[model samples]
Target: MILLRLTWLSLLNRKATLLLILASISISVFLLLAVDMVRHQVKDSFSSTVSGTDLVVGARSGQINLLLYSVFRIGNATNNISWQSYQEISKHPKVDWSIPLSLGDSHKGYRVLGTSQTYFTHYRYGKKQNLDFAKGKPFAGLFDVVLGAEVAKALNYKLGDSIVIAHGMGNAALVEHGDKPFVVSGILKPTGTPVDRTLHVSLEAIEAIHVDWKAGTKIPGLNISAEQALGMDLKPKQITAFMLGLKSRLSVFHLQRSINNYRSEPLQAILPGLALQELWQMFSLAEKALMFVSALVALSSFIGLLALMLTSLNERRREMAILRSVGARPMHILLLLVIESSLLTCLSVLFGVALLYLSLGTLSPWIQSEWGFRLIVQPLTLWQWQLLGILMLAGSCVGVIPGIRAYKQSLIDGMAIRL
Candidate 1:
C-alpha cells in the first residue's frame, strides 16, 4: 500500500514532468515500431509478388532487368524475344509450362499483362498462394479480360464492362486502343501482389490489337477493328518475356543454367527470388539510412525522457525523504523511481502500438493503391516483443542516473525541504 501511495504521490507532485516523460516514450516507441512495420511490409511485398516459379526467361538482358520489366512491370524492355522463340523454349523437354508476358501497355496507369490461362493456374504470390476470384471467373474467350482487385475497384469496372488499353507505360492519354475494347470477364481477389495493379488478357488478344499496328503508329490509316482482328490469326510476333516452370522442382537450377546457355541468342533465365534479392541490394543503403534515422529518433526520445527524469529529481528528494522517515528504505525509493520509469515505458509502448494499429486501419487502402503494397498490421511477433523488451530494459538503465541523484539528495538534506 505504501509503495502504491508513494508512486501516486510522486507522479502527482510533478505531473508536468511525468507527462513529458510519457510523451517522449510514446514518440520513441512509435518511431521504432513504425519503421519495423514498414520494413517488414516492403520485404513482404517483394516476396509475395512471385514465388515457386522456377525461372523467368526473356530476351538478352541482365537478370535484374528481366525481373523488373516482366514481373514488376516497372520499365520497358529494350528488345523482345520473338513469340517463336518463346514457343521453342516452352517446348523444351524439361519444361512443365510457360506463360508469355507482353508489356509496354497500360490501362489508366495499371499494367496490362498479355498471358495465357496457365498464368492464373501457375502464378502464386505471398505464401505460395494462388489467385482467388473476388468476383466472376477466369477469362474463357479471346476478348475476355480479367481485372485485378485494385484495377477493378479503381476504375469501377465490373463483369461485362468494356475498357480500352493505352499503348504506353504510364498515365499518358495518347495512343489509346479506342478501336479495341476489352470485356471484363473476371476480377481477382486482392492478393497485394503486382497482380493487384495489373490487367490480364490473352496473348492472342494482344496480337490481335496490334496486328495492323506498327511502332506506335496505326499502319498509315489501315486501321483494324476489333471484330475484324479476331477473324485474323492472332499469333504474337514478339513478346517481352516468358515465365517458365520446370517439370521437376529439383531440375530448376539445371534448367535455368541450360536456358542461360541457349545457342540461338543471348537469352537469360533468372530465379525470381534471387533476382529480387539482387534488386533489393540496390536499396540496401537506403534501408540502412532508414534504420539509422529510426534509431536516432528513438534515441532522442529516450534522451528526452532521461532529461525530464533528471530535471524532476531535485523536487522529488523531499518526497523521498518523507517516505524514508516513514519507514521506506532507500532501496524502496530506488524501486519507486524505477517503477515510474518502467510504467512510463510500458504506457509508451501500449500507446505506440495503439497508434500504429489505428493509423494502419485508416491508411490501408491508400497504402495499397499508392504504393502497390499492403501495410499489414498485426500483433507483435515474439521477435518484436523481444526487441521491445530490450528497449524497456535499456530505458530502465537510463532511469538509474536520475534515481541515484534523488537518493543522494534525500540523504544529504534529510527532513529538510529544498527545491
Candidate 2:
C-alpha cells in the first residue's frame, strides 16, 4: 500500500510527462482496435448483402463475375438467358420464388434495374430483412419507377418526380430515353448495400424503352410515342440474370446441377454463401496488412513510453537517495516502476475504448452510406481481450529497463544527494 501511494505521488508530480505518455498509448490502442473492429464489420456487411436466396442463375460465365454483376450490380453480362427458359425454371416444383433482373440502363451514374413487383415483395438482404419503403408504394404503371434511398437523396427526388434513363451503364451514355420519362413512385429505405444505388422498374418498361433501338442505337426516323410503345407487347425476350429461393434447402444442389446441365441455354448457378466465402479469401491479404500496421503502431507507442521513463530517471537521483535513506530496498523501487507502467496502460486502454465508441456513434451512418458497411458497436471480442492482455504484459516488460537502472543507481547513491 505504501509503495502504491508513493508511486501515485510521483506520477502526480510529473503530470505533464505522464499525460503525454497516456496520449501516445491511447492513440495507438485506438488505431489497433479500430482496424480490427472495422475489418470484421465490413466483412459481415458484405456477406449479409444477399441472403435467403439459394442460388444466383445467370448466363455461362465465371462464378465471381456472375455473383458480382447479379448481386452487387457490378460489370455487365456476357449474354442473357431467354425469358422462356426463365419461366420454365421458375415453375420448378422445388423453386419457391424467383426474381428476374434486366440491367443495361443508367440514370446519371446509378445502375437502373428492370425487375417486377416481386422484387419489392420477395427480395431480401442482411439476415432476411425485407425491403421497406420510406415513402409511397411500389410502381403501379409502366412509366412508374421506384428509387433506392441513396438515389432519392443524392438527386433530391420526391414522389411523382420525372427522370429519364440513359442507354448505357456509366456516366457517359450513347443515347438517352428522354422521350419516355419515369415517375418516382416509391423510395426504398436505406439498405447499406448495392440496392441503395439502384433504380427499380418493371420489365415491360425496359422493353418499351428499347422498342425503337437496334444493337443499342436508335433507328433513324423511327419515332414511337410512349403511349404507342405501351400498347405494343412488352414481354421481355431475355434477361441478364435471376435469383432463386428453394422450397427445401436439400434441393439446392439438385437445382444447381440441373441449371448447369440445361439443354436450352448455357447457364451457371452459384451458391451465394460459397461464392461469398471465395470472395473473402481473395481479400485476406489486405486484412493481414492492416493488422501488421496496427502492431507496429503499438510497438512505437511502447518505445516512446520507455524513452519518457528513462529521461525522468535522470532527474530523480535525489529522489532515489530519499528512498534509500528511508530503508527502501532496490527491488521495491523496481516493482514500483513496473506497477506504475501497468496502471498507465490500463488507464490508456479505457480512454481509447471511450473514444472509439464516441467516434462510432457519430460516424456510423456516414460510413454505411459511403462504404456500405454497417458497424455495430459492441463489447470487445475474445481475440481483442487476448490482445489487450498481451499489450499489458509487453508494457510491463518494457518498464523493467528503467526499473533496473533505478535499482542500480539507488545502491550506489544510498543516503547521498547527487545534485
Q: What clash pairs does model 1 have? A: 48-126
**Candidate 1: regions farther than 4 A off:** none
TM-score of each: 0.94, 0.91
Task: Specify the poorest-scoring 10-residue window by lDDT in model 2.
Answer: 365-374
- Across 1-419, the per-residue lDDT of candidate 2 in tens digits comes to 99889988998999998898899898888888989999888878778788899999999998988998999888999999999999999999999999999999999988999999888878989989999999999999999999989889988999989999999888863578999999999999998888989999999999999999988899999999899997999999999999999999999999999999999989999998998888888989988998999899989999999998899887988887788888888888898888888888988888888888888998987886666566888989999888888888988988799999988887777778554
Q: Each candidate: what lDDT?
A: 0.83, 0.90
Could you give me the TM-score of model 1 versus the true structure? 0.94
lDDT string for model 1 (55-152, tens) is 99887778888898888888778788877778888998889888888887889989999988899999878778998998888888878899999999
Highest lDDT scorer = 2
Q: Residue 230 of candidate 1: its Cα lDDT?
A: 69
User: Which candidate tops TM-score?
Assistant: 1
